[model samples]
Target: MARMATHMITGAGSGIGAAVARRLHERGDELVLLARDAGRAKELAGAFPGARTLVGDLANPDRLSWAFSHQPLPDRIDSLVHSAGVVDLGPVGELTTRAWRGQLEVNLIAPAELTRLFLPQLRTARGHVVFVNSGAGLNAHAEWSAYAASKHGLKALADSLRAEEHGNGVRVTSVYPGRTASPMQAKVHSQEGKEYDASRWIDPESVATAILASIDLPRDAEVNDLTVRPGH
Candidate 1:
């Protein structure tokens, strides 16, 4: 029998990450979820029994290496999925440096650091890395300056990693989903002062399907980028 695949995921507490975790858990795969604290770690452990949790605050990317040195990392990881992100909307003229730093830390730098830390295990397993970027990664709107910049940087990271890791048998994919119905979306709507309507957007599960498809493809082929838009 083929060995069960293991996936390490961030942002599995809600949204697309939760959907992906549920699907993988149901399929009898091993999961390692990243949490910001012991309490969040406990919550993830409870949510997905038998899955492991690692505590490392994404807000402090510089400390992840130090944090992981003190924790037990999975011996093998078939995929490392980056689905955690934060967004605050404001015009460039009004946005604070703190706001810019917050989004950059969580959305861009955290994923990059996590990938660097896990590259050894990932290369050993010939694993895949999936970045759950946003449509803003492709286009920056008025108030989305900071968030978009981070995601745009994420795209460059994925692209560069793919080029560098291809010979190592490590696949890199970026999934750009447009306005998914997630807590992040709700928060974005709140910031925009718009009424929240979950039904109008793509479902988290739909995006999860795209992510899993990229991960599950045969070793002979790889998906470089995937874009999911609301069907309605």
Candidate 2:
């Protein structure tokens, strides 16, 4: 028997989000890919027939709410993956309020709001939620205060949601990936050091595989948190 499911993925235009979308599509899952760039979203949606695309800025609550309100909520959502994030590298003292707020809005607030909006559908399906957090959420580093703070908040939110949703048939997984080979990482390394080899970094495909493992686990068992790092 073919298993049918609906999945919504943010940041699905690239990186781990794109890999996860492809993997889920290959497994015969229906997908709704959301990204700020309509062109990129359209390109990805074309790769999977019947898959849908929604373009909106995560940091814009009105845009997000409008998009969700206009679209018919799925009867059930087997999975919701929050992968959209922004990283700003600067000394804490030099960071502006606007930068801090932007980071929080994109990394923390958007995911929380989106989850709340989709809670009913997730409840109906007993779905899983995945947060693509960073190792920065677990450990601190200089020159990344804003990004780290947002990720830490994200981690806390995911942990709290997991505890609250226990036995309610909703599983939450926080993925702390260390130095993934993504465009975001490239930007980070460009300012830091070329010593950070993309080849030595964790592959988005591998991270997506781990996510799939969590999603496919037996209903009675849940993988709460997973950390994926490249072999050093």
Computed on alpha carbons, the lDDT of every model, listed in order, comes to: 0.97, 0.87
lDDT (0-100) at residue 84 of candidate 2?
79
Q: Pick the candidate with the highest TM-score.
A: 1
Lowest summed lDDT window (length 10), candidate 2: 189-198
Model 1 TM-score on a 0 to 1 scale: 0.99
Between which residue pairs do clashes occur in model 1?
A: none
Q: List per-candidate RMSD values in Å.
A: 0.6, 1.6
Off by over 4 Å in 1: none
- Candidate 1 residue-wise lDDT, 112-152, digit = tens: 99999999999999999999999999999999999999999
Residue-level lDDT for 158 in candidate 1: 99
